[model samples]
Each structure stands twice: as structure tokens, then as C-alpha cells.
Target: MSTQKRTVLITGCSDGGLGAALARAFKDAGFFVYATARNPAKMQSLAALDIETLQLDVQSQESVNSCAARIKQLDVLVNNAGGQFVMPLSDVDIEAAKKIYDLNVWSQIRVIQAFLPLLIASKGMIVNNTSIASVAAVPFQSIYNSSKAAIASVSETLRLEVEPFGVKVIDLRTGVVKSNLINNLKETQHPKLPDGSIYEFAKDTVEKALRQDGFEGQGLDQAVWAKAIVGDLMKKNPPALIWRGESAWLSRIASILPHGLLDGTLKKLVGLDIVEKAIKEGRH
Candidate 1:
């Protein structure tokens, strides 16, 4: 029997993001933190803290398999590597949407399967970081919503399957957080997002919405959120779903509403209603 403290490996833990915050929180809770990112250079600050840093790109099976192979044991696996792009479902490039799903959905499946042996050995927990939008699907974020919803579903199935093996599975219904999400938005240049004729009404508003969700983020605090998640990870019997954050309440509310009502509510909230009205009035 090994007497070493539990080890936690979190993906996409570059600096200035929630994954990094989670690594710090887990370390504070006395766990060995292996914080990984596609580009290890981005995690130099975390490495400076003596946290193990690896270049693990969930998008690449070779990267995931190699990282998993290096670890003899893992107590917690946090699937936090995900990305998104905002655009109308109509205008979104299918290829771009597929890429988001590959990162958010398939990537998680790949990592979890690769780490299953270690998890089964330790009877450890797996936390798949999903979004509130999973069940609270809103417009213009269809691709993101769909990908996260798939996570929620697959996590539930994973929980059932792994329970007999004594492995706990958690779908962390993450709310909007303060992190590089805003930076990601700023770093990317999307011509259609701001000035496309079809997107004129909502693009700027959507940009504001994403920035607000990441900054003001409705009072989202990364440190606080990470603390909550780490606490759950340490529990002897954690919930199947650890749901919290700025949008958690709204997500719950959205779930109770009818599809039509929910869609209408989201349109108004994100300025999609204005765009719809313009289209109805035949205005360019």
C-alpha cells in the first residue's frame, strides 16, 4: 500500500485561468498538483511553485496517453481543458463547431479512458468540468451548450459504470468564472463576430456578454470557486454533480422553464431579441 498523499492532475492549467486556480487550491488542500497545459511554457509560474507541470494537450491523443503513462498513480483527474467560439448556429462554421466538440467532448473521453486504470486502482474520483449552459442552453452559444450538455450526459453514465468499481464521477457544473476566457476572446480576431451584416445586432452585445461573464462575471471569483471544487474533491463521498458558480442559480431556473420560455428569456438577455426583431422587420 502506498502512503503518499493523493495526487491530482488538472488539464488546461495555464496561468491566468480557472484550471491554474484549481491547481493552487488543490495544492493548498495538501494534494500533489500536476497542472498541465498544451503549452508548458504557459505554466511556468505554476512550475515555480514546485507544482508538477506537463505539456498535456487533450486535443491530442498522443499527448494524453503519454502524460497518463508517466503517472504511476492518480487520485483525482480534473478534465478542465475546453474551448469555445460564439456565433449564431446558422453562421458558425461546421468545422469550427466540430473542433470545439473535439476539445470539449472527445478530448475528455480520451483522457478519462486513458486514466481509468489509475482511477480504478486508487478508487479515485474524476471531475469533468461542464458548464451551466449544459442544461440551460441559450442562443448564440449553441455549440458550447451542446458540447457541455454531452459532458453532463456522459458523466452521468460514467458515474453509473464506475460506481461498481468504487470510482466516483462528478460533473462539475461550472458557472462563469473570472479567468482567461476574456483573454481568449480578446486574443482571437473574428471578423464576423463584430461587424458581419447578419451579426451586427448581437455581435457587439455578445462580446460584451462574454467579457462581462469572465470579468464582472456576475461576481464570479476564481479563488472562491476553486476552493469549492477542491473541497468537494476531498470529500469521502462527493456528490455526483458539484454545481456552483455565478450562473448556477440561473441554470436551475432555466431548467424549470419550458423550451419556448427559456429560449425567449435567453434571447432578451443576450440581445438576440433585438436581432430577431430587425430580421422580422426586414432591416439590414
Candidate 2:
């Protein structure tokens, strides 16, 4: 065992988020962790834990460049800075949806491009944080699902593109782990009022589906989830795809089901079956 530690740079590591959890887990595993956030102050506790912290807004090229410039030996790069868009596509504000893609999709490209030199030198790996939504688009979160689906595509193309350079890119299709995202997205502004759209009469049902993360015993702990991620990445022959989280198996099942069956199941689970019945009965 060498005392010299491999360095890892992770974005969106604000406290209480999975990024911060990864920072701590990697730090505990003897990796030098660079925990970054759009606002460094949000990661003050990470600094207190002796992990290096950087201020990085992945949406801004300058910010990405500055952060990349400061890293001299990045052995692993994690793209985790992203937001959620929870609404029907018809009512999804195009501008806001673009912002979601900017953060969720393009930010990964920006950071990867900026740090490619370091990764190439280290023969390192890129871990992209995508969601199971990529496999099966959720009912109202179409924008979010599509954005992750884009990353899913990018991950495959990138893995092939970077393999000859001795760099590996892994798409981590994470299932819901407990995080502040649910709380944060509650504040997300959408153009459609819940009470005045296709879901107007099914507002409660729709909202419940949005909030119900398929977790076991409360939900997966962010720390445990992060540990699993870092653990898998550290494997000698890490796969191109690493999938795990609460009810993650369910997502895998959902992904392979027949299209009609999957669609019908999702609609019924979200109370759409009831909504459809109500609509037919003059309820809406």
C-alpha cells in the first residue's frame, strides 16, 4: 500500500448531497478529494473535514476552467451537479427545460473536456451520475428523463471515444437515494399550475407519484449509496455501467418490460388509471 493517494475531483458537493457523501467516502478510502460547489461556502464542512474544496459553477465555462486549472492530478472525475424538472412536457417551460439540460447534460461535457488532459495523464475514469429515469421516463418529469437519457447516450459514445486514450467513462444509473433534491425541487418553478392542467383533477395523485421514491425502510442513506459507488469504481475491471440504489432493481425490471405493460403499470401506480376513469365519468 502506497502512502501517496490518488486524487478525485467531484462536482456539486454541497453538504447533505450525495456529492458531499462521495467526497467523504473517497477521503476515508485514502483518496485526496476535491469537493466542489457553485458556492464554496456550501462545502465549508467538507473543508473542515480536510477535503480540498473548490468553487465551481459547472454551467459557466470560466468556473469549469478555473477549477480544472487548479487540479494538478485528478485521477477520477465525477459529474454530479444537476437539478430536477418535475412537470409534464407539454407544460414544461422550454427555457427552464433548457436550463435543466445545461446543468444535467452539458455540464458533464464541459467538466470532462476541461479536465481531459489530467484524466488522460492519469489514465483515469469519468463517473457520470445519471438516473433510472433514463431507462424509463417518468410520467411528469419528461424533461428530466430526457436529459438523463441524453447523458446515457453520451456515456456510451464517450466510453468508446476515450478508450484508446486509456481513460474510462462509466455511467452510474443511480436509483433514488435520500437527498435534499426532493425538498429542493418542491421549490422548482413550473409554468403549469398543478390545479389547471391535464393533472388538474389528479393533482394529489400526480404529486404523490412524484414524491414517492421507491425506497426500502425510509430510503437509502446517501453515505451508503456513495460508498457503493466509490467501491464499484475502485474495482479492477469496473463495468461501463454501475447501477445501484434503493429499488434500483425495480428500475432494471421496468426497463426491460414490454412497452405497453410498462406504460400501463406506471400510469396505474401514479393513479392515472383512476384519473382516466374519473375523466370518463365527468370527474375532471
Candidate 3:
């Protein structure tokens, strides 16, 4: 009987985020957990729990290669390190948008490519932490939403490509879970509609909408969400797509419904209707 413990490596395990919570849950589930963040110091909580924490800047090829080289064995790889950008497409900083894409979309591919050898050897699973926003578009988040959508698409294609190696690919279409993603965005980016921009007339409304995306106090607890996610991932034949979090079901529903039907509701939810009215009235 093989008594080897299953090993899992998860990225973006900074404190107070989904990655960290997942590390704890995976540990409790009896798997050897490797929790990582761009800055190891941010993983103090996980380190105190005795989980092996590493520094992994997903956007850096050298960092990803170094992190992969350290792990002798891996049964699962959870790509969870990502960033958010909130601004109208017209006024968004191109470089900032590219940075988000690098972190959210390209970085996942980078890590997967770097670690594919280990995954192929174990015939393990790859879980890409995409979001409900991939399907359900929200106002002022064009770049972030599209990046997630691109990853979801990539995960689908990757599933087919990796099947021959006995590796499983899972697209985790996450809904809103309580995390510091938005708070970090607010502190670091403070995205705003530029002066003289088309959406400037709705600056307050846009900014408020950005801040109140149902993630602050309304989303599922990170630990709770992580538990459910890990439970699903640990199944004998884990599902290809798992949607678990607040409003996840709603996003699923929206994905199936006609976009025309959802357009008005989405616009109203984010106060885009008022912005449209103001634009039509030449309020800009």
C-alpha cells in the first residue's frame, strides 16, 4: 500500500485571501500543502501554521521555474494568484490593463507550462481559478472580465490538450468570495474615470459601483468557500467545472440566458443606466 501523502501547490496564498484559506483547508484534508505568494512575508499566517510557504511571482518566468524546481512532487496545482482592474474601457490605462492580463491570464499559462512535467508525471489535476465574471460581464471592469473570460477559454482548450497525459483540468468559475482583492485594488490603484473622459459625468456612481461589487461583506466566507472547493477537487473524479460561492448559481443562470435579457439588469445593477442617460443628455 502506498502511504505517500498527496502534495498540492497553490499560488497567491497571501494572508486573508482564497489561496491562503485553501492552503489551510488542503492541510486539514491531509494533503501536503505548498502555499505561495509573490512576497513570502505576506504569507506569515500560513508559515505559522507550519505550511511550506514559498515566494512565487507568477508573472516572472524565473520565479515560476524556481518555485517548480523546489517541489519534488505535486498532485495538484491551483492557479489562484490574480489581480483586478476596474475602469471603463475607453479610459483605462493600457499598461495597467496589460498588467492585469499578465497576472490573471498569461501568468496562469506560465505556471502551468513550468509545472506541466510534474503534473504529467503524477497524472494530476490543474485547477484554474477563473471567475463568474468570465460569463457575467459587469460595467467598468472590461479588462478584468475579459481576462477571466480568456482564462476560462484557455482552460477549456487545455483540458483537451492535456487529456492524453492523464491530467485533469478544472475551471473554477468562482463567484464572489470575501477576499482582499478589491480592497487591495482600492488601496493601490484607486481607479478613477479620467477627467474629460466620457464616463466622468458618472464618476461617483462608477467609483461607488466599483467599491460595492458584493464582495465586501456579502460574499461567502473564504474558509467556507475553500472547504467546498477542496472537497470538490478531492473527489475521485473531480468535476471539470465547479461553481461555488455567493451568487454563483446566478452567474450560471446568466450564462445560459440570452445576453439581451441580462443586459438591462446588469446595467441597472451597476447604475450604468444612469450613466447612459447622462451621456445621452450630453452631460459629459
Q: For model 2, name the residue pairs that clash.
A: none
TM-score to native of every candidate shown: 0.90, 0.92, 0.95
Ranked by lDDT, the better of candidates 1 and 3 is 3
Q: Rate the local accuracy (lDDT) of all candidates.
A: 0.83, 0.84, 0.90
After best superposition, candidate 3 residue 211: deviation in angstroms? 3.4
Q: lDDT tens digits, residues 1-284, model 2?
A: 12258989999999888899999999988898889999999998799998889899999999999888777787899998898877766566688889999999999899999999989998999999988889875677789989999999999999999999999999998887888776666556523444457777777766666664442235588889988888999999999988888767788887777766677776775566787888899987
lDDT of 1 by residue, 81-173 (tens): 898667667677788789889999999999999999999999999999997878876777788899999999999999999999989999999
- Report the Cα lDDT for residue 67, model 2: 82
Question: Lowest-lDDT window of 10 residues in candidate 3?
Answer: 209-218
- Candidate 1: the clashing residue pairs are none
Clash number for candidate 2: 0
TM-score of 1: 0.90
Least well predicted 10-residue stretch by lDDT in candidate 1: 210-219
Better of 2 and 3 by TM-score: 3
What are the per-residue Cα lDDT tens digits for candidate 3 across 1-284?
Answer: 12289999999999989999999999999999999999999999999999999999998999999988888888999999998888878888898889999999999999999989999999999999999989988878899999999999999999999999999999999998888887898888876677788766778888788775555766899989999999999999998999999989999988888767888888998899998999889887
Best by TM-score: 3
